[model samples]
Target: MLTQTVFRSEDLPVADRFDAWCEIMGRVYAPMKMTSEFAADFRAHLRCIPLGEVTVYPTTFQQTTFRRTPRLIRQSDPEAYHLSVLLDGEGGTAWDGHEAAYRPLDLHIVSTSLPHETWSGRLPATIVGVEIPRAALPLPCGRADRAIGRQMSGREGVGALLTQFLTHVAADVGSYRPDDAPRLGTVLTDLVAALFAHNLAAEPLLPPEAHRRTLLLRIQRFIHHSLTEGDLTPSRVAAAMHLSRSYLHRLFQQEGITVAGYIRRLRLEAARRDLADPAQHCIPIHAIAARWGYPRAADFTRAFRATYGMPPIEYRRDGVRRQPC
Candidate 1:
């Protein structure tokens, strides 16, 4: 399922707003309450989408107050995990006789079964939440819960990577494809687990498979940042990351993909983005391709057709013709 809904504060009346929220919250939480004051003028600029097997709701709260507690001893679906990434403001949680604080970019994972209270203060705030099945997470539930409400800075290591991933996904919500949801979900799960593992000082607690997966993620990030450079090759990527080319190749092989193939796919993805842009409608297809590393027009066309099922010119023309009136 790939259903999405967008809500803007300016679109609804103050009196009817709380009812709207209840409809949305009911889909995720079993029992929750909304205050009248919290509902009126508690502006929410948000979107919710069902991405594959998971559901993601990205919300920006404007100076509001609310609290949520589980309605049952156990969640209706024990198999699911609720992960929250704090984008702004301050909040706190008290669960299992433990209290913790949260700041911007901090991720909190709470079991659906836990009885916890979360409060966002008077300041405006934004959060992106993902609901994933328990089987999807590679970490133990006990250790994972221990990370809730603890601050994790988005400037270093896996925290930075996870922050970037969430930021990008939220920014480009309309561009994602049905096929990209599951893979994106996996990345979200892995990054959350990596961040939790780093915080617990329990690197050894993670399975070996997770360690290798995280390593490849770091490598992929490096490649994505350096994609525009002509020198961004296997050798350059290896040297920049201080890994041997053979080792890099082996890592990709484990994932059943090749380094060169990955590079090509990234390049094609970038080109597709440009082709669909109305601002770039006047730019020649060859120029767009060259900007993404395909220097020759013929080569760019061949690669674009092979990857996208159509030539660059046709894709761009179709994209422009479909613009809203």
Candidate 2:
């Protein structure tokens, strides 16, 4: 487990901020020579978050250029790969005779073992990065290395999902605990591998856990969208998503319910909300039930009473009366 560390260059005197930043950067990433025309005007902040086995840095810096020289590579290399996602400004990374440009929502990787250069052109350049040990990726290093300095996008597909995930993690970091580290690390690995798999057209190479997670999220989203469709059922959902009925049931089994049961529960919950809403009072109880896919008022009332301990009309009057004002 890794505790979060924050560093802000604004906390230092203008004369000391640059050197202090270099010192911290050396430890967090790797030893490197950094040059920035805006160093005299330097202002930066970084969140060093450790997710069990990997470290992520949500960083912002003014115009800067960084180089990993051969001499610097041997000093204190972590032998890890840095996956950088540019959140602002334009940046470029070059290594092994290849160069890639990164704009907002673009991502690329850099290998600490190889000499490379990255530079920013705009004002404050904000980026989120994860440093992972080569062995943790489940991919051959050589194949992965080819992607170094090659710009990829974080705007759609798995890339978009990853960017959202990272941003969410950064925003919710305060709620995370030490015990959550290993699971968080696993999530990071799965997302990264899935991204690479999608990019390289190697979906079969993705970890089983990643595929399972992707399917579950997609299914839940579909359930939420189809809640009001009267004909929605496990068989129909499976057909729409191109999954076997048995497989869909097995997936929902992990959630302690059959797929059909899950859909029914969602429909019932929606019906209950409508029933309790004063604005919905003018609407007939049968209409509200049909609105949530419960065409039969008797069936809806039975389920509602079983769950909430009262009939729909009685519960609505009681609930509304209990409200002050």
Candidate 3:
């Protein structure tokens, strides 16, 4: 059965909360006994549940002790990717001769089958965990394992998007419908893949078709946001995104055009829409041209004629004349 449980440390005595948490862990790692020596000062806010084929758990705690002591060996194969996001915490993990320290908004991925040890000192911490089948992720199996116990910061771009998505989901877990599980699972997979791709310097590893479509969508969004700026040139766009001007041009070339040509077409499209609107009939042609980044009326007129075989004034006049009563 699908189930969701929310717990607050203050709702129960500290000892009771600790015991309950251990029980939850037991269920999560069924047939494997789990134990913890929670600090007397421990406190937490947590939610756990099984949604469809995925298990989502979120925890916020302070001054906690965590250890899988006398580590019980699994009698069967354990295959799952445990993705964790540290919302607020100071901690580190030791495994396979590697150690990683984590701070706020950092993500960590670890495998359940791994022999690992983690410790969070006196600092308070919050984390969101997503447990999914290894097959759910679209990447080489060993790729994520390499990043395990390492910190992935959420300070910019795609990282920021993933961080925000996790934060929103954690804050509103109750509002999500059971039917949305598959879609949510896919989103989680995509976000994880994107993060790994960024980490590995292997953006090309992303399915080429999907990567191109995603890039185009991002470009379109960037262009739309800067439409009001007169100097929204390819160079400026490239610079804003830390891409080289030549690289930006190459991207536009994929669509069979140069960057400048694309910009011109988009501006002209906007100008055409404005001219066809009856509410803007009284606006001067030059004003419309300037609004769409044309600084000189003569230049705008020449370009409009070259593209549409007519000047802006005539186009607007003809368009209005063709309107039905």
Candidate whose lDDT is highest: 2
- Candidate closer to the true structure by TM-score (higher is better), 2 or 3: 2
Stretches of candidate 1 exceeding 4 Å from the true structure:
1-3, 63-70, 73-79, 202-325
Determine which window of 10 residues in candidate 3 has minimal summed lDDT: 29-38
**Tens digits of lDDT, candidate 3, 141-237:** 8886665654467777677777777777777766888777667767877887788767766332334544453455456446755776899998888
Whole-model lDDT values for every prediction: 0.72, 0.80, 0.69
Tell me the lDDT of model 2 at 158: 84
lDDT of 1 by residue, 1-325 (tens): 3356888766887666767766666565444454422453446777876666667778877533334555543435455667777888755555676555566776766666567655554466788887877667688877777676455567678878987887778778667886888777777778877887888885334446545644675577567768888788999999998999999999999868999999988889878978987877999998898888989999999999998899999999899889987
User: Which portions of model 2 miss their true places by more than 4 Å?
Assistant: 202-325
Whose TM-score is greatest here? 2
199 Cα displacement, candidate 3 (Å): 1.2
Per-residue accuracy of model 2 over 134-189 as CA lDDT, tens digit each: 88987788877766754467998888988988887877787788888778888988
Checking candidate 1 for backbone clashes, the offending pairs are none
Enumerate residue pairs that collide in model 3. Answer: none
**C-alpha RMSD of each candidate structure in angstroms:** 17.0, 17.9, 19.6
Task: Please give the lDDT score at residue 84 for candidate 3.
Answer: 75
Indicate the residue-level lDDT of 142 in model 2: 84
